[model samples]
Target: MTSYVVSFPIRDTVVRSDNNIPWVLAMHSNVVSIFSCFRRAAATCRSISCNTGNDLSLWAKERVLAPYISSERRNRIERVLENRTRNVVVVLEHLHSKGNENAVYRSMDALGFQEAHSITADEESEAGQASGDPRTDAGARKWLQIRKWHTTRDCLLHLKSRGYQIIATAMNNRDNSSLPVQDVDFDNKIAFVFGAEKDGVSDLAVEMADVCCFIPMIGFTQSFNVSVAAALILYETRMRRIRMFGRNGDLTDEEKRSLLVEFYVRALTSSKARRVLQKYKYDATDSSMTENI
Candidate 1:
């Protein structure tokens, strides 16, 4: 008999088994409400064969743990995930202000973009938790994923590897061939790159970008702030996507399922979560759901 263990924040894991392990559980003070459900569920699930760590994790999350989340919360999560788009990421190059980055993320959240990458000037940069305008929320920041890279080349390379078309933002004076922001076509997954407060993107950014775009302005103030540029470009791209597809979001079924699980776990593991481990209500008849995982 073999055992499969799936543990998160892996500490104080209790395994109940001899020849085979029905449940391999790791509970903690933080997510105790989540994993503790497995203890009671284990009794009915003993006949359940050993599943790989991911399989076990999914089952525990969807079957054993998810129902503890309230109906209102579940509906809200689904509604948000419906509009979530996996494409259209943003990149910030050498942006020093956390307030600016936070503002960008708030825009990203509103526009249904899920992730952003930052090419920091150095490893010491902490470009998050803005305490500025649009009133950035620290908790809302957690709803979006922000990754920072130490160099422009590394960030661009990673995005390229993932099939992103790098759309660098520049002024009309800076790049003669750049497309007007609203007119640019989004034929592929995109990474819209914006630069710092005083300076625009790095030379490498312009050189590596697959396409260049700039906002059209008639005023004497020829440029937009970094955050403002990001908002305009992101909003235009998002609206165009909605018009092209006739909806605000285009997440696939698999993507929606994955995000749903994550959202459920996030809600369940929070400090405010109270009731949990509802008397082993899992149905063995729906065993096929675990097989797909």
Candidate 2:
């Protein structure tokens, strides 16, 4: 088995160690290390909780990168964090065009949505294409959790298991079969499924959906662009959420802190810093920490 090592910086003037060197944590075989944050480093200590391996990884990354970010930047992250929600998610089924997907990502990120799922049963590369428009999307890809599944059933089933109401976006012609996006209740947890560009929603996806939603169109056009529809729907949902729970909605302090850590980590730009961050992302998923423990 191959072992992985994780290292992070410690401000020299504030943190003192052997020869004033940076802090390093080496994990091998069954060994792991945990470090505390600066404010409470003296009292806090490391513990080996096999179940908390992923969480430990998060904390470790936050510890290393959080201090480097400015207070102004942190405040900006906090403001966005309040409006963010896991209550609603967007899903795209078999979407081939990177442009459409990137647009949806931009809209989702703008509305403070934290996750998006895709069922690319036919095109496996759709998920990877999100990286194609980093500049255009303004790096929204870094902030959102995008998941790709192989089948519509698999994606819907997983969302259902999480207690999300799967709402499929349907065409205008499907009158009785669909409701206006605004008419649908945004109070409940929803996973909106948008189909491919050519075919729209899959038959199976439509069947599995808890409800079908359509955007109202007055003109001769049958539908809005997939990306446009996504923006409109998310905007409506955001407004509804705000109406119900103020602009900040129901996001908790813990949630804000978690997102702050992630956003702070992502804000790092130097080549050396990015390389370290990459290791943190990869090693964070070490399944052995869960299965073997």
Candidate 3:
């Protein structure tokens, strides 16, 4: 017997076996993979697939959906908005596990980090899609900005241009070059890079990093799981920010309003969203006319 895998773009995944029976699955982000088993007598296989459309900007979509969301839902979105921050970022370098990737996203969301970065040197690896498993991510992927790069050097240069200090997580400090996680100044914009689960941080990433840091561990276990380490580091950073600033850092008012629109759009059904968006466009035009008067 042989099995074939087909991927479809629908929110609800439907898998058809050799008998052409469809198996429906819960909606999830990323390309859905389905397996079909065939009898040994069958020498040929058929394929079915679909392409998801281009991503729409959250800011644009939000403008259309803002008025359709309930006040309670709006309030919840506002709460998320109040705590969201881009001041600190995490960069996962060549992390191979989907669960670990999702765990990191969940941790970042819990600690209110708005953006993350990933670097994968291998051109043919599925590591690029590590963050695509929404089942593991618990919907945290929707709330955070994820950027992927082909090389650590490119990622470092990009972050540096945006004034982010690159910090790599290492097993131990080299000479006097690295800082203790506790001592790193959380007030500054920083990008913390954690390496693959087994390899730790790569030598290239370490070389490109402006600072190298590690969590002080004790007892028989010398290291924490990558996800656990990220959570600990982010939690520490979040607490320091709250203590020093009297509150967790937040997005700007304009940013909140934009994201509010985005959340509203995402919550509505596609048909309702289209109607709401049209109304929003007309309302904006009318407001502009009144302002011109």
Colliding pairs, model 1? none
Q: Estimate each model's TM-score.
A: 0.71, 0.73, 0.70
Q: In model 1, which regions exceed 4 Å deviation?
A: 1-55, 126-134, 173-175, 269-293
Better of 2 and 3 by TM-score: 2
Q: Which wins on TM-score, candidate 1 or candidate 2?
A: 2
lDDT of each: 0.69, 0.69, 0.69
Q: Give the backbone clash total of model 2.
A: 0
In candidate 1, position 177 carries an lDDT of: 84
What's each prediction's clash count? 0, 0, 2
In angstroms, give how far residue 13 of model 2 lies from its true place.
17
The local distance difference test score of model 3 is 0.69
Candidate 1 lDDT (Cα, whole model)?
A: 0.69
Candidate 3 lDDT, tens digit per residue, 1-293? 22334445544554434443333343554432322212211222222211123223444345346667677887888888899888788998888777888899999988898788877766624535733577777888766777767888888888899888889988665566777798887777899999899989988788888888888877898788899999999998899889989777577786666556555655665576565556434232111111110
Q: Against the true structure, whose TM-score is highest?
A: 2
- Root-mean-square deviation per candidate: 11.6, 9.0, 20.0
Error of 2 at 69 (Å): 2.0
